[model samples]
Target: MPINILMPALSPTMEKGNLAKWLKKEGDKVKSGDVIAEIETDKATMEVEAADEGTLAKIIVPEGTQDVPVNDVIAVLAADGEDVKAAGAGAGKAEAPKPPASSFETPAARAPQDEGSAGGKTEAPTKPTTNPAPRPEEGAPAPVSKGEATHNGARVFASPLARRMAKDAGIDIARVTGTGPHGRVIARDVEQAKSGGGLRSPAAAPAAGPAIAPAMSDQQIRALYPEGSYEVVPHDGMRRTIAQRLTQSTQTIPHFYLTIDCNLDRLLAAREDINAAAPKDKDGKPAYKLSVNDFIIKAMAIALQRVPDANVSWTEGGMLKHKHSDIGVAVAMPGGLITPIIRSAETASLSSISAQMKDFAARARARKLKPEEYQGGTTAVSNLGMFGIKDFTAVINPPHATILAVGTGEQRPIVKDGKIEIATMMSVTLSCDHRAVDGALGAELIGAFKTLIENPVMMMV
Candidate 1:
């Protein structure tokens, strides 16, 4: 027996997806974990995986086809010598996938064609097969042929409702003419006829109505254009995902910003002292290089312990505080930002945090991280200090109550004991959700972080 491969819902909001590309061609062997295709959902381009070990038998929807709804069979996989018929023979021959509401570019505007006649009379007949498909109702309005007229001497191809409506409204259908289905009268035509006080003959209507200049002929446009072509490109999968997520976050989250400045001279000196005594690599780099980020991570751990409320998420029922601090560090990637978590950061040592950050950052940049690595953190940090950003606020990554953005440290004059002196100062801004965290709580949390940074020794102990 063959296994049917239905389109998977890549995102929560995704209903249908475009078959962007097939990773496994027909007859190719596939394992459960292997990526079989790249599916384009409203959010992103996700890799579709096989559910079982088998050979790719047939692809129902070819690449580039859009509107493949979720859970609809898109392909088939089977073991060698398996019968394809066992997996529904009519799989690929189902009705064409309906495009989105936006894809209905043209209005319902073509003239109806003549119905098939049997023995000199038109008759509706039932279609029979193993499928037992339903048939259209008999004795329905006859499909009008081209150049025919209705009973009132109007074009026979006019829609029945339009003709009857015209009669009820005392408007002439023939004079009104039509802009639908092979020039047949439509509802709009009847409405226009009623509004205009009967149908105006094409020649007489324009003459009596509002004056308008004729449209430029295609030949004239061709003459004006020396040479230029227009092309439309579809939105890539990654772009689609970014757009949807950002929109959702902005629309629903109630975000609030809080800023704090930290003196970093002590932090820098401490990093140097820690790195000097650490092991060295073969290439001469410190084995456990204690960077400013490492100190910040350690300081954050202590701050979280002090202000445990900050290490929590907002929920419908109540404020859900976590016993452990799981921090997600946002890493910039080619497509967008992806944060990898440092689970139980409150308990991890500075050296361990440094190692975990390095590993997760490397994997995140390489796009080799698992789904769990990028999900479920109590709080998140995004640092742009390396890029020389002075100060900035970050968006809250829900269901987390707050996110911290760190900026670069620069030498600045500060008053110490009534004397102005040059000191290294760094700025950080915390964006919080007002629903989950209050202004006073956020300020207090920042104060604790300030203490950890100003007194670096306290964090280590």
Candidate 2:
């Protein structure tokens, strides 16, 4: 059999992906776990590994192809001692699964891809999730219950029979634990779920309330503007994904914001002294230079530790309290922004965080970051200090219950002992998922952050 090389889902939030480049050309020998291609997800470019070994018999999807849906075959492989030409010929004639009309974000994606076409044939996985994950490309019907997780409010991926069974059982399919590929609920899993081990409380489902109304119709909105005055710049994959994810976030997660002003006198001085003492390289450049944002990252990480209750993700089932602080730092790029995370940030030194951030920023701008670097984090930090924005609330990217928005530091007058005095202050807004973190808990978290930030030396300990 000619083995199909399907587009793998790199993250839980990625639905479509760009087939950035084919690292291995057709007719090349392939080995298991070989990094055969690079797929560009919404936020990062990932090198995909081959799960099986064979000769690369055909390339069904070419490089730079965009918006390929998940599980669409991009290439085929010839088995050991099999005829390569026969494999290629057979695979080329095979039609990939057509994506649903709802999946098409543009006319370009809706159109079928010709060989060498820039449009992708298969996309990756993510939310903004409309359906259950496609089966693995290996063609195996996996039977294990691997605790497959669903994310970003994606619709449960269940077989038609499974859906029918659940419907007959009067069970909410969303509450059943999927045990198939990427946690897709299969027929057998559904059968086992009937015993109640797989069922979740009705509370686990989305809260019943008035739904968010749709915006004005496109035709209506266009009527208000002169036709030629506006040029239609089609949204690329990144922009579309951003719109969807943001919509999902706001609609699914109830957000509440808490703002506080921190005195930056000590932090500014500490930063200056740290940079001055930094060892210089042969190029005479400082080995490490700390930013106020660096201190903020450290403070936020420590704050999460101090007020652990605030660091949690809300699922209808329960709260997920993470042990380590994975802090995602938002970096703006061409089409959209990517939040690259610093894992275990609470334990890392200030200089380490600065260096990691610099590397993440460089890679992020190029869209060269791996999916793991940007996918899931417990919390996030968005600093517009360099942009000179005073303060703003950031959208809470789920999986992350809190996001701290940092503003520029400026000189402001404050009263001390009933007298006015000049002080350097920076304002920060913490956006919390109210379902997970209550007002008091959020206050405590931000309060701890203020203490560490105002007294910079506390972060050293």
Candidate 3:
């Protein structure tokens, strides 16, 4: 039997990916865990490992194929001792290896409960661990195309991984209906379907409410511009993901802004003193060059610890109060921006934070960051101070209760004992998720941040 090589989902929010290149050609010997191909997700290009040991019988989805949906057959492999020629000839004709229909059967007969999809998602889906069998069995069940059902000219909407799971488990995906967004099947649904229950028929699904009418179509938007006046530039994976996540953030999270002015004279003086004392390497490069943003990050992290009530995430089940301050710092890239987190920022030294951010920013621009490096965080910081921006508010990224936006530090006149004096001042805005942090709680959190930021010495204690 020919083993189907489907596209793997590299991350939780990944739906489609670009098949960048294939390292092995057809008729080549491949072993389990061998690197076979490269898959380009939203921000990173990861190497795909071969799950089964066999000969590459066929190449179905060639390299450079863009927007390839997950779980679609990309290649075919023949098991060792099998007729490679016949396997290559049959290639895609062979159905995927499904274990048993009973695998999807369950003890409890109920509809699959997918919290994010059944109603709506509080956050993105969790990445599933997919370890496919390395060999083919003697007998497998008949397969359905991409987990589709045969009825009413209707098609099944399922994530690529769900379809693959159904095929591998010999389950009739049509019988195990979807509970994901817009009735699409997801990994959790498949897991619940394993019990031979918690699945409904596709025909029983509720009808779609209406077409996506709130937004204009691509064609209509294009028509507004004069013909040939502009050349169309398509969005890549990063841009698309950014647009989607930001849109979701703005729509779902009710954001409130709190702004305050901080006297940066102390912080600026402290940063210079710390940088001047930093140890230098043989190449004359300083071990650490602390920046004002580094102080802000440390201050915000400690402030969250002081005002622990504001450090929370809102879920339908309950509020999540994190123990550590995982501070995600926004780093601008060509297509968009990425937020790489500094784990346990409250405990780390300013030098460590600066060093880690420099490395993260360099790798992030090259699209070399792993998903875990940028995924979840208790809060975030977005500083446009380097760009000379006075002040601006930021959108609340989900799973985070608040984000602190920093503006440039410049000389401003201040009154001291009824006498005017010039002092370095910076403006900071805190965007809070109202559901998680109320006005007073947010104010308290920001106040703590202001205190620490203004008195640079306090952060050390």
Candidate 4:
């Protein structure tokens, strides 16, 4: 049999991906585990490997193809001793592999079952059908009914997995309609039936409303402006993802802002001393030079620890309290920005944080970071100080209850003990998720941060 090479799912949420490049060409003898191609997901580019040993018969979906759906055959393999030309001609005809068993299991799989009482009316548990049914071809219409009624009685024709799920959900499998090939009930049907038992087909289920309003088409918007007045630059994948995520964040999250001004004289003085006494490397360069942002990251991490209640994430189920502060620092790249996290920032030394951040920023601009490197964080820091921005509020990234916006430090006069004094003061704004951090709690967290930032020595403790 000719083996089909389906597009692999690089990430859980990935439905489609770009076939970036092909490492192997047609007619190449490929073995199991051979690197065959590169796939570009929305977040990262990953290498895909071959799972079967065979001669590369054909490439159905060539490299550079965009948005190839998962489970779609991208290539074909001529099995050993099989005719290569025959396999190439029959490419894309192989059946897709079954989905993982866990995807079929619903929440009700672990629910308590109601056993019959001593009323002597024990109902037999429904058993799943052992024979596997053929799957429907792509674009094939779904069957009208799930099962057929024989002369003896009505019989439920469902896969073993689907029947098990229906039984776990306490739903009558006979009542659930099937959309699989030849009117067979499948796992998806049973899973969808849990909410309202067999009331409607999956196709008939109500569609969810869009989270954000649709944008105007390019042609529609361009008609408003004069011709040649402006150039239309199309948005790349990175920019599109950034715009969508940021828009979702601002619209969905109820953000509350709190600003505080801190004296940075001590922090600057400490940074200079620390840099001057830093160790040298083999190249005669300083081993590490800490930046003010590093201090801010440390201060924020410690502050979250001090005011633990403020370090949380809001979910529909409940609040997620983090044990350590994984602080994501916004690094500006060519097209946009990415937040690479410093895991357990509260425990890392200033030098270590600075070094890690330097590496992250370099890799981030090159778009070489893995998804996990920039995905989750307890909180985030967005510093526009380098751009000469004084004070600004940042949008709250989802799953992070707060984001600290740092401003540039400049010499300013302050009244101290009824006298005037000049000090280096920096302004900061903390954006909090209203649901996770209340007003008083946010204030306390920012106050703790200001205390540590103004008194740089306290961070060492």
Candidate 5:
């Protein structure tokens, strides 16, 4: 049998990726665990390892191909002793078998039920009974459903039996609540929906006028400007994903920002002293040289520890309180920015944090980070001090309750004990997800950070 190689999902939320490059070419023999290609996700570019030992018979998707859907076949491999040419010829002819039901869900199939019921009820539908109708064969095609309705522009998923019941009852299948596996609407769900219960209307669809006007097409926008006045730069997969995610975050997450000014004189002095005392390596380079950002990271970590309530992520189920501070530091790259995390920042030493960040920043610029290096974090810190940006709020990244934006440190006059004084001050803004961190709690968190940063000795304690 000819083995098909599908594009792997680099992250939980990754639906598609760019086939950045292929390490193995056609006719190359690959062993299990051998890296065969590099896949570019929104956050990073990762190497994909082959799972089967075989000869690469054909490359269905070439390098630099963007937006390749997950599980779509990108290559074909011939088994041992099999003819490579014959396997390549059969690639497009034979369809690959469907994966297990647990792993074969589409985005629409896993969407949550719509808010606002017919009778002002807001409770979710109860789970359906376990005595489901006998499922088809493991590899059998799923039965088709009818009535096209969209949630977030994706088609709704329902069992064929549910569609039939919904059609007969004059109920919209999209409005019927799905309680089956991965929220798939089954026959019983549709039957229950007919009784004016157990159904959820599409969240994106409004009962009155359209929820939102459609965006102008590219051609329409381009027509407004003179021809040859501007050059069109095609969007890469990363840019598209970033735009979609940021838009979704701003729209869905309620953000509240708090700014604080901290005196960085002590921190700067401490950093200089610490760097001077650092040990040298075999190359005659210092083993560790800490930056102000390192102190900022440590301060934020300790602050989260002091104000544990602020270190949380908001979810539909409940607040996720993290025990450790996984601090993500935003690093700028060619196309966009990425936040590579230093896990357990509270536990790691300042020198360790500095070294780790140096490595992450270097790899980040090269687009060589792994998914785990940049994916999830309890909180984030974005420093634009180097670029001379002062006092700016950052958008709250999802799954992170707060992100601290640090500005450049400069000398400024200050009132001390009713007298005038000059001190090095840095302005910092904390952008919090209002759902997760309340205003008072966010203030307390930033206050803790300010205290640790100003009194660098306290951070050592």
Candidate 6:
């Protein structure tokens, strides 16, 4: 039997992905856990490893193809002496292509629904939602969730569902008009349709019938808007998953942001001293060199110790605070970003944290990070300091109550004993979810972070 290499969900939020690069070409031997390709998801470019030891036989979706949904086959790995042709033959069937938006009838053609009068009960217009069939090509105008109407000779679109109810109630879509994005008709349009007692133009009367149109390819319609060359890329598996999860998170989860500045003079000096004195590794490389990020990770671990409430997740039942400090460190990649966790950070020494960070960062860039390294964390740290960012807020990674955004440390003036002096200052912004962490608790956590970062020795203690 041939093993199909399907696109793996690189992140919890990833759905569709683009094949960034193929590490192993066809006819190459692969071992279990060997990296096969680099998949660029909305969140990050990640390594898609072989699950079984076999010979790579066929590459299905070639690199640079987009909109490959999760679990879709990208390659075939056949066993020793197996027939690659037979293995690939069974897997070569393509799924049905997504329908184009233009295939559906126009919203104005849909039958109207009944609405009650204003004296007691009133009719309402139906809202339109696209029951989009399968995958629509890129730029396939998504079916309007609302209906459409003609107002003063101008055709305005509203949700199909909304239009039905509005017409049944004897409401004039033209008089009521629209309030949706791009001046489209929405539910609000139906509500105001009755109140809009404005005079109707003679042309406001109903049309003879729906205007029928000829079928055309999506490429043809898109060509009309072309000033420059534009192409529709299908959503890869990873991108689709990302879209779904982010939509859910944004809709259901309430997010809040908090920011603070930490003095990094002591922290910077500590890292330099540690790095200078660190021992060499078996590979003759430095075993441990504490970077500013290592210190920040250590400080964050200590702060989580003081304010355990911040290291928690929200659930339907109640808050679930984590006992351990598994700090995820955000790493930037080609398409997006990934946060690989430094497990048991509270117990790990600065040297160990530094080593692990170096390893993770290198592997992350190379698209070799394992799934375990990128998932499940109590908190997260995103450092833009290396990029010279002054300060900025971060979106809360789901399930983690807080994420610390660290900025660069720059030399600035400070008052010392009534005298002007220079000090190194850095800013950090903590994004917290109110449902999981209260304002006071979040503030206390930042305060603890400030103390540990400024002292630089507290982590050692």
Candidate 1 lDDT over 1-461, as tens digits, reads 77778888553224456788998888688888999998754323568888798778788888988767567888888766676445445345544665432211222221241111000111223333477445537734444445455544332445555656778987756676554323445565576566563355545432121112233344654576654653324444344445434433454567888898899888788888888889887998877876788777667766877998887876533467888878888888766677788888877888899998889777776666755676678888889999999999888776578888999999999999999999999999988888878899899888898988988888777
Model 4 pairs in collision:
146-178
lDDT of 6 by residue, 1-461 (tens): 88877877554323345678898887788998898888764444577678898788888887876546556778888887898767767667544323322333343333221111000011233744478457657745434324444554455454543466577878765655433323344453465455543224556542222222433455665667674575555433333334433443454457777787777888888888877887887898877666788889988998998888788977533576789999999887654567889998999988889889888888787767766787779989999999899999877766678889999999989888999989899989988888888889899999999999999888888
lDDT of 3: 0.76
**RMSD per prediction, one decimal?**
17.8, 9.4, 11.5, 12.8, 11.4, 14.8
TM-score of 1: 0.63
* C-alpha lDDT score of every prediction, in listed order: 0.67, 0.76, 0.76, 0.75, 0.77, 0.68
Taking the tens digit of each residue's C-alpha lDDT, what string does model 3 give over 1-461? 78989878776546567789999999899999999999877777788999999999888887887766566788889999988888878866423332212212331222222222111112222444477435435444223344346334455556556767888998877666554433556665576678655566556643231121133344655688766876656556676456545655676678999999999888888889988998999999998888888899999999999999988887533577999999999999888898999999999999899989999999999888888899889999999999999999999876798999999999999998999999999999999999999999999999999999889999888
- The model with the greater TM-score, 2 or 6, is 2
Quote the positional error of residue 302 for candidate 4 in Å: 1.4
Question: What shift in Å separates residue 118 of candidate 6 from its native position after superposition?
Answer: 46
* Candidate of highest TM-score: 2
Worst 10 residues of 4 by lDDT: 112-121
Candidate 4 Cα outliers beyond 4 Å, as residue runs: 79-81, 93-211
Candidate 1 colliding pairs: 43-241, 109-181, 110-181, 110-182, 111-181, 111-182, 148-156, 149-155, 149-156, 150-156
lDDT of 2 by residue, 69-187 (tens): 65678999998889999999998543544433433144323322211112333323333456765666664533333343332354455544456677898876777765433244545
- Which regions of candidate 2 deviate over 4 angstroms? 13-15, 32-34, 52-54, 92-174, 177-218
Q: Residue 216 in model 6: shift from native, Å?
A: 22
Please, what are the lDDT tens digits per residue for candidate 5 over residues 410-448? 899999999999999999999999999999999999999
Can you give the TM-score per candidate against the true fold?
A: 0.63, 0.77, 0.75, 0.73, 0.76, 0.60
Model 6 clashing-pair count: 42
Better TM-score candidate (2, 4) = 2
Model 5 alpha-carbon drift over 4 Å, by segment: 93-214, 218-223
Worst 10 residues of 5 by lDDT: 113-122
